[model samples]
Target: MKNKFTLILVLFLYINLVNCDYYQSKTIVPHDLPNKVTHLHFYYFDIHTGNNPSAVIVARPNQTNEKNPKKSSLYGTVFAIDNPLREGPEETSNVVGNAQGLYVSSSQSEDVTLTMYVDYAFTSGELNGSSFSVLSRNPVREPTRELAVVGGRGKFRMATSFALIRAHFLNVTTGDGIIEYNVTIFHY
Candidate 1:
């Protein structure tokens, strides 16, 4: 009886071990290369927020994409913008948009340029009061030439005092986007 019991216990252990290995192998192997993460971080801002007004966004890298079996080479960054003028109480002379500082993780490759863009719905207001412009001072240099987009909706009446803006940043690897940034508001 003891011999039979021992035999049964050994068989159970062997089966479990084999099954565990099989499952582990299946889970560990990838069927194909990983897709380069196309999107990294995004920023949403309410323009109605009182002046000293401005919105800033930063993209941070995540680590889940590093060990994938298949991967793509890093490229550049890209951005899209959307904004339009609005009807305002006054001919507000707010310049409305600017993008700068496209940098990369200190530990990763840095052989790329950053791209930014803006698209918007037209704001119907006093020519000067409801207007929008989008520009970037300098492009970021990194391995991936992905894109980062920023822009807003037009029309800022008393009810719609500000615009809604969205920005997206991208990277090639999980480690590329992880970053530290500072947003400053300068007022006179």
Candidate 2:
């Protein structure tokens, strides 16, 4: 009788062990990858002047003159932008989003570069309420600039990618310009 009881106990323990292993195998998590990629195209208006401008010069460096003023850098200068992102180059075009942030002239040399930190927040279309953050250096004179997409929110969550900003139009005297942007984002 004692040997039969011992055999039953061992059988029960074996069954519990098998069940535990089965449950554990079922609980294994699936791997998440940044496999999805998407492209977004928009136009950004750099409005530095007018009564109601989109971008404004918030700070500037002390007066300094270089032999070639045009070759001089805008170091220590800062600008704040809440620029409208539109479907077309015209400001009258339908507003899709807004690029809001601050960019500072970080280059201490002759290059007119800005250390940019901006968030593109959408207000219309499929990506409404979604936004992505950009943190990179922008050489304004470059015909095509690539900026890194650090992260994002909403549909863009866990995203990483780049943005191609090309010169669309420029007004030298007014410091107003229109830029074409093509952003590619990857996410889980």
Candidate 3:
């Protein structure tokens, strides 16, 4: 009887271990190469003028904080955006996509700096419904900046690239800007 019980227990352990599908996992590199590379250029409109604005300040620094910068630098201000993307720098130009996200002024320097989180959602092309994400720090006073293309979907799936952004036109009084973007993307 003792020998039979031992044999039954050993058989149960063997069966459980032999068919353990969830016991381990394996890592693999993609068999397909990342051979598709594309370049794109567009204009991003940050319209803050008129009755209908595309971007608006949602939060501001405490007025009593002496260390906080004023509106000149916009430090500690957060803006929510649903701006337009155009084929040309002009606001009336053809609309191709939209940029929807939020940005915060995080720099204490005299020059305005923003930590931006935005997504470029394409609307009117073969790439319609596809979107790519940009999360980066932008120094607005600088002539040029490079933003990271963190991730993407649809035609831009598994994308890894950067965007060169520059202020094409800026209205200091109203805080409006038409920025240009040159993007390079690589995907499988």
Candidate 4:
């Protein structure tokens, strides 16, 4: 009876150990690659009138242009450096990554909402070519916004984190602006 009880207890302990996600007493070693730091420039044009060529107006039922023309959506790519009015991407500049997403706002409304997905690629670093993705949401009109780090690849594989976004320049007249993003990621 004693031996049978001991065997059952040992089997239970083994199963629990195998099913556990992490071991408490195990040593956690740091990753071989260093943390990547990047400051990216997010530029938007004609944000107020939504007149930029990239901007598109989505239509909804029972919505008119004068009232609620659905919402104006704009999407474009961003760079690692701060280039407000530049026409295209600068190759000489450090190409960290790109942001391809859109923002929408009501007619004649100052409050706008945005959903941007930012992907980061290290150009020259210990973890070069390794990339991570951030899903950003702007729920209201504010000077600063926060983004969630959803996932990643390569050295940043399975990473999760967040970011802080601040508007560096916003031209109410031309409806152009430059936003800065500071991201923090946690990975294996």
* Residue lDDT tens for model 1, 64-101: 34666365333432222222122221225332332222
Q: What 10-residue stretch in candidate 1 is worst by lDDT?
A: 179-188
Backbone collision tally, model 1: 35
Local distance difference test, each candidate: 0.31, 0.89, 0.89, 0.54
Task: Please state every model's RMSD to the true fold in angstroms.
Answer: 19.2, 8.9, 4.0, 8.6
Q: TM-score, each model?
A: 0.20, 0.77, 0.82, 0.49
How many steric clashes between backbone atoms does each model show?
35, 0, 0, 0
Best by TM-score: 3
Off by over 4 Å in 3: 1-28, 65-73
lDDT (Cα, tens digit) per residue for candidate 3, span 42-160? 99999887899999999987665466444255778999999999999976899999999999999977788899999999999898998899999998888989999998898888888
Model 3 — TM-score against the truth?
0.82
